[model samples]
Target: MFAALAWSLHAADAELRRALVPTSRYTPSELREGLCAALLARSSARRRRVVLEVTLIAGVNDELQHAHQLADFIAPIERACFDPRRKSGRTGVLINLIPYNPTYNRLAEGETVESRNDMSTLGIPHYSFFERPSWERIDAFQDALRARGVWVSVRASRGDADASACGQLATNRKLAAT
Candidate 1:
């Protein structure tokens, strides 16, 4: 389960998400509530663990407040997984925090191309404001989640040297093709 903007159900949150990830067609409510419900159902039925990956973008959704919202959002799902009434042993949700990698466009000119039409052709947007959170910030965010009893882990970046990081794949493909 990938939820880069999990707290984006409210009007302001949704606007922030739209600015960063305009290509996303699903509403924030659908992405948050609907996806959580589906994941909970699947985990209960299959008796398996679910891992939710959230990409942390600096000044976008990496604040401590967002961490609290995330904890609140996943609380019910986590409880459902560990409900004593359910015979499932240890099925639960784990959150993986992935710091945003500097993509090709970000590294190239330090500015995003604002043309939506151009971005549509490449199937990727150039997020000028997106940046990886500092180590201190990441740690604080992790601590906040842990304080709320939510299991969480910080993911290390891989393939970043080759522009194949999490949000860089599509842009890399387009550049390679060109």
Candidate 2:
């Protein structure tokens, strides 16, 4: 996604891409390797695009520091194709920050909604968690991203009234199970 902005359309995908982040599943080095591989994949004509998607759960990963860290991560890629003599303005990477939905809670065993647990259980041995981000937090985070020159956007809340959106699936299944 970052490198492809500078690549010709023929070398990239027509639609923007996506990738889940905070991949609690992998270590920092491993994450770096994954990003490098994606970049290499694009530059080498093996793939067209790669969009890094990170869900910002209100107080969890919505911190300004997270934005900075993300910016730092993609800075080098942004400069990779730059030419001082030419105005080769790059379109840059598209980062889609999705705020968590609370329709279905992924509480840990023995955990309850009143507990206010903000920790993530992803990639952990055996755990899951869920939370939602406030509109204010989302705005501020997007501003931070803009300051970093990163192309960032909040994934619009879709199908909220459908009762079948993300998180809600579990609830729907439970109701059916009953």
Best by lDDT: 1
Q: What is the lDDT of residue 85 in candidate 2?
A: 45
Q: Score every model by TM-score.
A: 0.67, 0.60
The TM-score between candidate 1 and the true structure equals 0.67
**Runs with alpha carbons beyond 4 Å of true place in candidate 1:** 1-13, 36-48, 83-91, 106-113, 116-126, 170-178
Candidate 1 lDDT score relative to the true structure? 0.64
Clashing pairs in 1: none
lDDT by residue (1-178, candidate 1, tens digit) is 4332233232125455565556778755466566556655664434534566778877667889888887876665665456465453433667888888877354344533654223333333346545788999999999998888787888889998887887666454344455
Task: Specify the poorest-scoring 10-residue window by lDDT in model 1.
Answer: 3-12
